[model samples]
Target chain A: MKIEHPYLMFLGDAPDELAAKTAIGIKQWRPEWCVAQLSLPGCQADLGLPEMSIAEAKAAGVKTIVLGVANRGGIIGPAWMETLLAAIDAGMDIANGLHTRLSTIPELVQAANAKGVKLFDVRHFDGKLPVGNGEKRPGKRVLAVGTDCSVGKMYTALALDAEMKKRGMKSTFRATGQTGIFIAGEGISVDAVISDFISGAVETIAPANEPDHWDVVEGQGSLFHASFAGVSMGLIHGSQPDAIIVCHEPTRTHMRGLPGYKLPDLKTTMDVNLMHARLTNPDCVVAGFAINTKSLDDAAAKKLLAEVEAEFGLPCVDPVRTGVASIVDKLQEI
Target chain B: MKIEHPYLMFLGDAPDELAAKTAIGIKQWRPEWCVAQLSLPGCQADLGLPEMSIAEAKAAGVKTIVLGVANRGGIIGPAWMETLLAAIDAGMDIANGLHTRLSTIPELVQAANAKGVKLFDVRHFDGKLPVGNGEKRPGKRVLAVGTDCSVGKMYTALALDAEMKKRGMKSTFRATGQTGIFIAGEGISVDAVISDFISGAVETIAPANEPDHWDVVEGQGSLFHASFAGVSMGLIHGSQPDAIIVCHEPTRTHMRGLPGYKLPDLKTTMDVNLMHARLTNPDCVVAGFAINTKSLDDAAAKKLLAEVEAEFGLPCVDPVRTGVASIVDKLQEI
Candidate 1:
């Protein structure tokens, strides 16, 4: 779904900073599109943007109100209804990444219909998608795969895209998840799609582009995670990337939510990902590594990165501290 | 959904035998369950069963009227409503495998509610499924993986289950597709599930069982297929099969629905499937091979099977022509 900007970031009584993760991510990645912040009474989080009402946001030419907070139970509680309706009346579209569908709220639906504003629920994908044909499409693509879930894959992708752009290369960030979608302003939440269309949805998200252009596609679940490897496989085959940056978090003892399942080693993870990826793009290669060294001291993180680089003969970096310039440089060979 | 036995197969105005493919498959695999057949005036297909009205079928102890025909469009047409409603009134539940949802028919819904009957739409999966946790569970599960889509995966699964039972082994057939669901009387159409829950739904389909018991799980799609590798990946990881029987059609030149993409070699397909399967079941192995030889002459089919058997040092048989006896024999090691 394409959510138009500039957006009014809605932090509707969010309980804490983590609740406003999506909004914070949007502001961090696409600062130009986040025109203002709209908060309800008792809201505990902020994006540090100019506080604005519906009228003020409209005056600033806000095109959409982004429901970017994760409230308890992910519901649109009664407390947030009045402000949401006011924004709808102000002629701005609504983009939500919540369990509660915006279309489920009758008053918002009615007002949005009257105002001709669109409602985008990024978590639900009902649009028709073709089965993936496995055809090679024109474009150079790179995907950020991971050793496990929540291991900085999205941050690596965005960093790669930014670095590529800074190098004056023709590149675009292709988002495949919620926060990524808000940052990119468009994408398919591949995991929410019907299983049969996972690859097809990814194909649409990163369709054919100019041969010289790079679609730095954001990846999803780990190929080693039992709960979601299917989505990961489809993403790999669908994007058909020429290069993949392996993302990992070394501090985790096991896979997320799976106590006994240890995260696969980076070598196995990369091999498995590349094996499936070769189905669509035979020449797919591992460009580099993105280690989420958040828990590590700078010296320790650098030492680990250097060891991994030495072992694999590829560039390795923490997308946060070291930057992905070397990784983007490696992409030059493609 | 577990559909009751003693089924009245409904071939409502089937234009051709292909339209009644589900009915034909159920009759072939679960002959005892096919008590009778019901047809409309314009029906052109026959299952060679006793013709019975809804009342007659109910009197003969039929518990479910299976809407086993596909109409021009996958819709509950006006023509079939009267018969469907009558069946509900006759105290038989409706189990539909069509794209049309049986719950959408207002009259049928109203009648079924009053009669305390249920509607089973096999194609739609709205039930809640937990995310797969990648834990190894009890039971010996053998999945029938394939070289491409539309190979003999389901047939081989059924054959293995049947032969295992004949040998006094505790075995059950786990269905993963529409026809397999109808034959087994229960299963999740894995492809129809949400992408994130593919593996989770599969774990439900083939849950932990007796240590010596075998769940001969029906596989779907191919790990090598572009359109549906996601489903295949999930099925492999979720079933955690101790042994996998690779099913392949000997005469196919390319992957299904993709003209340019050639099917992976049998060795590659088996290795890939086993590699993924080993995530949960570390000792997973390729138990046998099931070759679909319907397109080949008897001599050629036999020769091809022998060649594959020698090449891989595995039991190889055509489920239709030579039977899957050898494959079941190999499962004894597991």
Candidate 2:
């Protein structure tokens, strides 16, 4: 089950020039592994030469071939499957980045098993590379938020982390959840809504770079696990805050209708939810942004804000208006 | 580019078993092509001999291998990919089935292209082997629906189809969208809420089994694009019936907070959405069902029914009470 000599071969929509770039990313991430991208002839889309390419890979001493297939209609089509089989015949172990239900293909699985070819499904990783030291313990103070799969929650987290750095605040982005948490530096006022959600009572506090002592918040509910919820509750109980700021996609409705919950129009519901959190934590301030508001007009946007103010009875602001530049300023003033 | 003596390999979860089954399914679907499942040595999950199996597969004159990888987190994971690569190294053509975002796997894509592996993504085949006569027609209709994917829409369609059959009605499940019109049959109904949302039409009739025809309905409002809204509308319009039966998860809420649309409590909202559809189609009798009600007591069930009747002003029945068999019987009588 262990590969003694493994070489990488790229397939399906694999850019010729980008092969080096990929090798770089992999090397950067896993420096211990001797990884190099193997090129094969007849690999171009126009040539459609599956068998010839596979032969080239085998000749190049490539023990492992990574194949890419297209994603269409929420699944992969048939063309890619034909090519993958050709490579297997050419004597190369296969790894695929095809967006199709591979479970449906039985013959391929059996063939690989018989050959002792190790297959790796790449979709689960979803741009997630392994991080942190292998020996490190799992960190605490984790937060998980529910979000639309496409929303750039990760990007927002990165921006927030940058803002924290500019303000001389020590914070770390917790990568376990859909988005990371930014721990604040000293003398930073925690938003009431955030404080309440965390159950932390703090007059003024800052985020920590390490997970050992930091406030963790996430945007998507799907990523929220019971253990994470318990950890959040523990953090909140341990440190009460003056305010809490929640970054979420307002329009996305929670699925399957949990008890005592109503599906909300993505925009208004987000505002109301944030406001409700603020109401529960009177000493906290709540802020939210409509992640999908690019197409929204001024009038529609104003109405959404008004509804939030009316429902939650709290002062609210958009993340865009405050901007990443002013995060330190706002934290300092608070 | 032609694969002269192409060896196709299937790889994934239970690679050996899946490959065997798929070879059978494919052969049955397309008898014109000679296909066989190949087994490799040491690929079995049973922890048996590895070298002997590989030798046997090669001896069988198996030219290709297909891999069936396991599905994880709504997509394929890494183990399957690794296995497929191993088979390619052992001299086999690879075909893979792994679904979920593969755009990020450049190395894998390159290897497959370079190795001339015929990769196939099978998620869109709807569990049916694709057997076509090499003919392409414009606007060909393909209908795909699942019971779980559309919140029991498939079951609802099946129930309605059964009802129609029982009535001795002559109806064909139209494959395409542009088929000639026919009178809506018994137990067919329109989904008013979905219709209103998509086409601005208060009601749109739908037939059984043709869940893909929702695009024809005009005048639906913004809610048409809500998750499963298209399927809902298609079910309504495709039926094109004199009467409509609405089946849905009882907890779901449709478009919330439109002007003059008071936000109903979760229970009330579900009921009202159904009722609204009934109101939109005055000529249709709306029968509704709440799926997955095995846990409720008689009293609780009655209360739910009462609430629906009170809110929607329609006679609604539980599918459980009118057992599936009984309903089929009634449809036969009609």
Candidate 2 lDDT score at position B236: 31
lDDT string for model 2 (B1-334, tens) is 1121222333334444443443433333223333333333434332121222334555655444444333334444465556455444555554333334333366556666666654433321111111111111121111122212223333333344445445565433321110011111111112211111211111122222333222112111111221222323223322233333334334434332212222223343343233323222323333343343445677776787677657766544454454344333333332
Per-residue lDDT for A229-321 in model 1, tens only? 999999998999999999999999989889988889989988988888888999999999999999999999999999999999999999999
Candidate 2 local lDDT, A1-334, one digit each (tens): 1222343434344334342333333233233332334333433332122233556656756666554323334343355566566656666666544435344478677767767665544332222111101111122222222222324334444455556656666544433221121111011111112111122211112232353333333332221211111222222222222223334445545322222223334344343333323222323333333233444576775576567556655433334533444333343343
Consecutive 10-residue window with the lowest summed lDDT within model 1 chain A: A73-82
Show how many residue pairs clash in every candidate, following the order shown. 0, 180
Any runs in candidate 2 off by more than 4 Å, and if so which?
A: A1-155, A164-171, A174-286, A290-322, A325-334, B1-157, B167-287, B291-304, B323-334
TM-score (C-alpha) between model 2 and the true structure = 0.32
After superposition, which runs of candidate 1 have C-alpha atoms over 4 Å from their true positions?
A: none
Best by lDDT: 1
Best candidate per TM-score, number? Answer: 1
